[model samples]
Target chain A: MSRLSIRSFSSSPIASKVGYSTVQPVHHLIPIKKQTLGKRFPELNIPKDDIRSPQYKPKDVYQDRVNEYYQNVLKSDLLLHYYEHDSEAVTGNKARSWGEFSPYAVYRRDRKPKGLSRATRDIKPVTPRNIPELTGISINLYNKAALEESWINISARLQLAQITNVKPKVVYNKSNVLPWKVRQGKECGCKVELEGRDMTRFLSTLVELVLPRIRTFKGIKDSSGDKSGNITFGLSPEEIKFFPEIENFQELFPNLFGFHLTFKTNAGTDERARTLLTSLGLPFYKEVKNVQ
Target chain B: MWKSGLRKYSAAASSTASAGNSTSISSTLLLTRNPVITADVSKFEAQYYKYQNELWKRLMWTFPSWFYYRKGTISEQAFRELNPGPVFNNPNIEFPRGRPVVVHQRDRRFKQELKLPKTYKEVSQEKKEGGETAAEEEGAKEDNLSRQIVPNSRITKADESKDLASLERQLSRTLYLIIQENSKWTLPTFKEEQVAQGDDTKDSSVTPLHTLAEQGLYKIGGNSINYFNVSNTPCHVHKSESTREYFIKSHILSGRFVPQSESIKFLWLTKEELGEYLEKDYYKEIEHLLSDI
Candidate 1:
C-alpha cells in the first residue's frame, strides 16, 4: 500500500512542480501499470523461462530417437561421406563495396551481390561439429475458397492442428487484386512451424505411414530446393487423405486442403540438405521431361 | 596442410614400391543393429525428466470434455462418472486452510488426473469376473483398433537369459556382429580373389569392396538377413604391411544372422563388450569408429 501511494504521488502533476528543470516533463504515450513500476514487484519482471516464473513451461520431457540417431550414427557417416582431400569452403558471390573516397559512399550500404538480388551462403565442407541435420519443418496451407467464404478456413486450421499437434497461425492476404478477388486483411489459410520432437514425429509419420500409402506419389523432385538449405514440396488434396488422423476421422473433415511443406535445414547447401533428408528416410527422384 | 600433403605423397610412393608384392585389399563389414528402444537415462536424468513432466502436466490446459463428449449424452455421463468434478469453491463453506480454486472441473493448484472410460474389455477384468472361459476368450475376434495399447517389455527374453548370440539381446544399445575365425575374434572381413596375370576375361574382373562384403556376408550368414548398406564408399581404412582392410558400414534392418558353417561362431556385442572380446590394439585403433550408444 505504501509503494502504491508513492507511485500515485510520483505520477501527479504537483510532483513535477516540486523539482526544477529546464525542459518540460513529458508524459508516457502508454500508461504504465503499477505492478510493472517498482522493484518490489520483481516476480512480474522475471523471465518466463525461469522456473519461478508463473508462465514457465517444461520442454525436455522425453528422449528423441531421431535426434539421437543423428548424433550417434549419422554425424560421423555424413562427415565421411562429404570428406574430400584438402577441401576448402566454396564461397558465394559476395557484395562489392563502392569506392571509399566517394562522398556519396559515406554511410551507404554496399552494392547488391553479383548476378543476384540476395547474397547466397557459402557451402562449407562437412565436419564433426557441422554435420547437416533437419532443423524444422514449416507447413503452409493456402485456401482459395476461404477468399469468398472465410468459415472454410476454420476446418483447414483444425485439420492442420489435428495432423500436427501444434496449433496453426492464420495467414492473411497482403495485396488487393480485383480480378482474382484477393483483398488485403482477409484470412486465407493457416501455417504451422514444427521443431524438435514435433518435427521428428511429423517426419516419421510422413515417411513411414503417409508417403508409402499414396498410390501416385513419387518422391520429392530432385530440383526442389531454394539453393540454400530449404527444400519445399506440395501434397495434393487427394493425397492428404493418406494421413492417419484424417483417415480415421473422415467425417469430421469434408474438404481437405492441399498444403506445401518446406523442410528447413542448417546444411548451408541444398545438396547436403538433400543428402541429410535422404538419410532421414525421405527419397528424391529426378524428373524426365522429354525422351526423344 | 603441408604435413598432410607430405604424408599423402609418402603413402603414394610406398604403395607404388609395394606394387611388386601386390598388397591384398580386404573389405571389413561393420554391420550393426540399431537400438530398438530409446537409450537408458541415468538416475539424475530420469528424475529431472520426471520432475519436468510433472510440472508440464500441472500447468497443462484443462481437457475440453464438452467438445469430445456432448453435454447430455450417454458417453458424457460415463465420462463424468469416471472423472468426478473437483471440490467447488463455495461461498457458504467455512474453511480453515486455503480456499479451493476450481476452474473447468479442475483444481488449479494440483495436476488434473483424468480416468477415461475404457473402450475394450480387459483380459484381467474378464478373468476376475469369471464370465468367459479361457478358450472362448482366445477365440474371440480381436479388433486391432479397439484393443488396449500395452507396450511390449523393453527387456526381451534373450536379454534376461544372457544370450550373447541373439540379435534381440540389447534393446537400447547398438549391437555389432563379430565372428570368431581360427580362434581369433574380429570383424567379418572378405578378401578379394587373386586375379590371374594372363587372364583378361570379364568374369575375372575386380569386385567392388561393398559387393565383396555383401557376398561374403551372404556366403557365411544366409540370404534371409535383411540389411541396408549405408554407402558404397568405404568409411574407414586400416592399412598393414600386407593387407588394407576397408570398413563398409551397414545396418541390419530385420531378420537374423544365421551362421551356415559349423566352425564359424558369431556374437552380437556392444562397443565395450567388443573391446573385451577383440584384440587390444585393434579395438584401440577402431575405437572412434564404434558408437558408444
Candidate 2:
C-alpha cells in the first residue's frame, strides 16, 4: 500500500466550525467519491472545471432550489398519503407536518421496541411483513413507550430502517404537540420526511436494526380531541419514515409524508404539555415539561 | 427537447484532466456542451418519451430488466425529472410565511486538501510508449455482459453489483440522445487518475487495511469481511451491515474469522420477534423474517 495514500479522520481531523444549533446551509456538497471510484464509477466524470468552479451562479442555485423544493414536497406527500384517513393533518384532503417525531417518540427511543410484553403492548410489532424496512431488525411498537422511559427522544429512527429491507428515512421531529388552529400555525402538528438513499448499503447496524428496537411503542389517543383525530408536526424531509403509520397508506398523494413532530397540547406551558400528552395517553418527557 | 448536462459537465471536466499525466478521454465521445434546459413539460415529455421508449426496447430486449423493472426505467426516470423535487429549487422553503426560523449550518468539508498525494498507478515509460493498449477493450462488445467484479473487496448482498458495460452503454446512449437534441454538447472531463503497478501496492501486505487501501476499494467505510488477516479485525462503532463488514474484516485480518471453517456468516431474521429471541452466535445459522407484512 506504499503507492496508496490513506487518510483517517481519527488521525487528521478537519473540524467543522459550524455548530449543530440550527440547520446548516448544505453550502456545497462535493460527493466524496470512493477512491477506486476513479476506476469504478465513470459516471461521476464531471468536468473538473465544473467541480473545481468556485460556486454555482445564483440563478443556477435558484433554479436547482426551486426544482428540489417541488420534488421534495411532492415526494413527502406521496409517501404519507396513507395517514390521510387516520390523521387530521389533511384539510379538504391535504396533509402537512408540524413536529412529529421528537417529543414522545424520538428522545424517548420508543419508535421500535425490541421486546414484546402482553402486559405493555396494545399493538405489538407485527412480523414486519407489509412494510419492509431496509434494516433486517424490526421492533414492535404496540404502546407509546416500548424502548425506554426517557424523554427528549433523539434516537436514530434509522436503526430499524435497514432491517426490514425498505428504503430508510431518518426522522427528526421534536414533538407531536398539536396546535390551536386547524390548518394554520398549529404547534401540535407532527412532521414527516424522506432521509436519503446513500445510507442504503453501509447503514449503521444499530440504525439499520437495533435503535428502532429501542424506539417502538404505543401511539396517540383515539378520542382525545378528534372526531376523526389528526395531528401536525414541523418536520424536515428526513424524519418522515420513523412514523409507523406510513405503511397503512396505499395510494400516492401529495404532501402526505413530509412533516415534523407536533402534538395536541391542552396546556401551552411545560406542565400543561405533560398534562396534554397524559390526556392523549401518549408518552412525553418529564424533565422539559417546560419546552414547547 | 431534453438538454444534456453530460457535455457541460465534460467541458468543465477537461480543465481537471490537466492535473495528471494520462491520455485524455475528454476529446473522446463526451463532446457535447448543451445546457440541459429543462423545458416545460411538453417538450420534456416528448424527448423523454422517445429516449425512454428506445431505452426500454434496448434494455428489456437485450438486458436483464429485473433490476429496473419499475415500468421502463427511463420512463420512471423521465417522470421523476418532469417532476423534480422542490426543495432543490425552493431556497426560501425554510422561511415559509409565518413559520419559526431554523438556522442554517455549514460543515467544513473534509479539508484534507490532499497534500500532493503520490499516484498509485504510474505508467511505465515503456507502457506509455506502447501507447494506449486498449484497456482490455472489446470487453465492451459483450453488450449483455455484466461488468467483471474486481475481486478486491468481498461481495455481499447489499453491496452494488459491478456491471461496467451496462452502465457505460446506458450512459452513452442517454448522453448521445441528449446531445442530438441540444445545441451544445461538451464531454465531461476529470483529473487523470493515478494507477500504479501491483509492485508498488505490496509494501504493507501484513495489514488488511493497508492491503485494501492499496486495492483502492478501501474508503471511508470499506472493510474486509470473511478474510483472514490482522488489519481486518478492528471493532466498529455499531453492528449494522457496514459494522459487521469491519468486524469480519478485522477478525479475518487478525485470523479470527477462518475462511476455511465457515465460522462467520450473516443472518437475515426470518421473523420480527427478535426482540424476544436470545442472542446466540446465530451470526451464521439464523434466518429471520420480516415481523410485519
Best by TM-score: 1
> What does DockQ give for each predicted structure?
0.22, 0.01
**Model 2: residues >4 Å from true position, as ranges?**
A1-155, A158-292, B1-293
- Estimate, for each residue in B1-293, the C-alpha lDDT of model 2 and write its tens digit: 11111212121232233433333321111111111222223576556656644432322111111222244567546644543322232456664444431111111212212112124233334445667455533444356365333233232323244322121222101111111112332111122233343322343322332243223222211244232222222212122321111221111121111112232221111123222342334312222211111
> Where is model 1 more than 4 Å wrong at Cα?
A1-43, A94-119, A237-255, B1-25, B95-97, B119-137, B141-145, B194-208, B239-243
**Candidate maximizing DockQ:** 1
What does candidate 1's lDDT look like per residue over B1-293, in tens digits?
Answer: 11122112122233334566777777899999988888888999999989988977765555656645667889889999999998788899976777876656777557788996553446558665987776665555363445555577899999999999999998899999999879999999988666664342333364767888999999999999999887666778888889888898999999899999998999999999999999899999999889888
After TM-score superposition, the amount by which residue A82's alpha carbon in candidate 2 deviates from its true location, in angstroms, is 27
Residue B265 CA error for candidate 1 (Å)?
Answer: 1.3
| TM-score of chain A, every prediction, order shown | 0.82, 0.19
Cα displacement (Å) at residue B103, model 2: 23
lDDT of 2 by residue, A1-292 (tens): 3411221212111232211112112222344435555756554555533533222212111123223322422222222211111222112212223347556544442332324221121221112121112211122211122123212111222222222223233222243433511222212221122222222221233233322443433333332322212232232223434433333222221122232233332221233233323422334332323576
TM-score of each: 0.81, 0.16
